[model samples]
Structure formats: C-alpha cells, structure tokens
Target: MGTTYLTARLNGGEARYKLPGGHPLTGRSTPDLELTDDGRLADHLHGGRALLLDLTDDPELRALAAGYADRVDTLTADCPSRPELAAVLVRPDGFTAWAADVGAQALTSTAGLAEAPEKWFGVPAGAVTPG
Candidate 1:
C-alpha cells in the first residue's frame, strides 16, 4: 500500500496500484540473460540513463520511447525465460523501474514507459530526442 510502483499521472491523479501481476519483472532485479543486440543486458545498464529492455514487437511503445532516446537506451532483445514480458525499463542500479506485459487478459503496463526517465533522470534537454 505504501510503495506505488508508478510515477506517471493517471486521470490527473496517481494510479491505483494492484499487486500480484503487472509484469513479472516489475520492481524486481533484471534477469541474467544474454540479449541478441547486446551480449548481456547488465552491461548496458551501467550508463547514466535507464535502459528500456524491450522484449516484444511493440512498435508503438518503441516509437513512443524513441522520442526520448536521449533519455534512455532502448534494447530490443528476446527474453527466453519470460517471453510474456513485453518490455522492462531497467534503472541504472539494475532494478526494474517499470514494465509492460505482452497480451490481453494479462495485458498490463506500469505507466513508466514514457515517464520513468523524467522521474529518475532529469528532464530531457528541450524535450530533445535522438537524431
């Protein structure tokens, strides 16, 4: 009840949190897996910005995240262990700051996809995106 996993505004107010299910990786440590793009995901997480460890083919989410490329390192990789996770936003300290799940029924979002970097890292320079 105390730790709200979300930072983004929902309906102009904080999102009502529910435990149990969102994405398996939400609020947990990043899994030790080798991604296709990078040999290891943990390798890229040491940088200043959070890494968007995307595991699905969600172009809209990736495109939306792309706008703030200057604020994050988007890694599109396959998670063989938990393929259900659509994406996970990994903080620099190697924790899952947010996540989005794969399909309906269990379809989910932690609301940090677009807001986490601004919450953890400072605002982007003039809302600038990657060129």
Candidate 2:
C-alpha cells in the first residue's frame, strides 16, 4: 500500500484524528499540477500556496481567483478534472489548506477564502513569506 493509505489508516481516515487538518492532493504529485500557461510541465518550488481552479466553466470564479495572484500560484484544470472541488488552496507542504466544492455560491468572492491562505500560507502579496 502507498504511504498515504498507510498514514490514513493509522489516523483513522478522518480529519479530526489528524493533528493538522489537511488532505493530500492524491493521484498526482504537486509538481505535475504546476503546469505553465502553455500546458507544459514545470517545477514549482514549494513556497507559495497553489490555487487550483476549474477551467471547465464559471468565468466569474476564474476572475476572482486572479485577485490572489500575489499570495498564490494559480493553476487551472479542465472541467471534471477534480470532481470534488471547484478550487483549492494548497500550502507549501503540498497539503490542501482549503478547498471549495463545485458551486458558484460556495465561493462567491476571494474575501471569504482569503483567511485560509493568510493563516496557512502567508500575508497577501507575500508580505509574510512562508517559512
């Protein structure tokens, strides 16, 4: 079994059982998700938060995600790519700090989601660099 499976088993497969509340990206490494705008794979130093956006629909959400450019390294995936989430803010440790389900109302604006990045990652525009 994989390390994650083993770890999850050890932790009772529940968020409350885990010391820090966050989930792994699963099925893909953080590097694989760090695709450039041209769709080429590239290395993304694990420093800033990663904002995963769904590119299948919702133009408004896409624009709202841009507001976090200073604090996050945004990445887009095709629709249905991640069925459970419409957007995710991943910490430098490759753990999801925050995730939003697929709903327009679930993530109305960047304001509602700003605290997670600041609390887990750092200040906006990288004012407080992640350790």
List, residue by residue over 4-87, the lDDT tens digit for candidate 1: 424334322332333233555666666666666567877777676778877876676677666568777888888776766677
- The ten-residue window of minimal lDDT in model 1 covers 10-19
lDDT (10s digit) by residue, model 2, range 8-103: 768655333122323343212332343335353234434554654443455655565565676667656643334655565555555555555665
TM-score, structure 1 vs. true:
0.62
- In order, the Cα lDDT scores of the candidates are 0.65, 0.50
Best by lDDT: 1
Give candidate 1 regions above 4 Å deviation.
1-21, 104-112, 122-131
TM-score on alpha carbons, each prediction: 0.62, 0.49
> Alpha-carbon error at 53 in model 1, in Å?
1.3
